[model samples]
Target: MKVAVVKYNAGNIFSVVHALKRMGVEPLLTDSEVELRSADRVIFPGQGEASNAMNYLRERGLDRVIPSLTQPVLGICIGQQLMCRHSEEGDTDCLGIFDAEVKRFQPVKHEDKIPHMGWNSIQNCQIQNSKSSLFKGLDGEFVYFVHSFYVPVCKETAAVTNYIHPFSAAMQKDNFFATQFHPEKSGEVGQQILRNFLEL
Candidate 1:
């Protein structure tokens, strides 16, 4: 199957590619509309600022092309934030595929770090018997996360993680799936999540 890792002005692109390679799938990293649209599955993974990333996407016309995609699309970290309706990072408007808003984490205590970094356990929030494909067979698993902004618990939330508060660890809406954590760096559990996305 053809998997495209979106190439843009964002960090961690190679890491995602490496993860897929470990899964025995060589993915194409491209900004070309044709290459992206033609792929069987698209992975929009990034580690960067919100507005800068959005600017790059808009400049390349990906902002318009991404939301219209019919195939499965997975957004990671900043990729997930940009997929939301809006973001508090740069007061930016993003691709409204998930109908959610990304907000900066407001630390209320000393331990509540601004950038909630490192590994954290993710709880399956899907209703009884209706589990998310992303979390299939993996429950209460720890995933690596490195971000200061988060999407609050919402209807689209597929998984939740607690740090400063309960926030969206992963989200799913139709063919679009997203995770605020870095699945590429989440070890075995991360590998499973990426494998699940590929199999979808």
Candidate 2:
């Protein structure tokens, strides 16, 4: 399959690339509208400040291109945050691919952390359908997550996880799919998620 990973100023791009290679898919990394549009599937993965990432996407016209993709598109980490309507980080407006908002974590207790790093189990929330689910065969599975910000339990939520509180670990809306966690770094569980995404 012609898998394309969106190229932008974000971390974890190489990790995502390597993960795909492990699955035997040589993914094309590009920011070109034509290349992205022609791909059978596309993945947008990143780790960065929301404002800076939004600025990068806007400059490359990817802000417009990404939202308009007709094929299955997956967003990871900050990529998921960017796909939401707005982000509390830098008080920025985002791509609006999902009708959601990204908010900074407000630590309430002693154990509550700023960046909720490490593995956390996920509960499959209301998935849109079986055909495009990334959580298929996943039951209380632990995936890698490293983020300070989180999207709340929204209509588009496909999976839920708790750290400071319950948050949307994975989300989907039509052809768009996203994960707040880094599935690429989640080991076997991560690989399974990628395999499920590839099948779609």
Writing each residue's lDDT as its tens digit, candidate 1 over 18-61 gives 99999989999999999999999999999999999999999999
TM-scores vs. true structure, each candidate: 0.97, 0.97
User: Top TM-score: which candidate number?
Assistant: 1
- Candidate 2 local lDDT, residue 128: 57
What's the CA error at residue 27 for candidate 2, in Å? 0.6
Error of 2 at 9 (Å): 0.5
Q: List where candidate 1 sits over 4 angstroms from the true fold.
A: 125-129
Clashes of 2: 0
Candidate 1 structure lDDT? 0.92
Per model, how many backbone clashes are there?
0, 0
lDDT tens string, model 2, 90-197?
999999999998999998998887799999999864575453368777868888899999999988898889888899998999999999999899999999999999
True lDDT of residue 137, candidate 1: 86
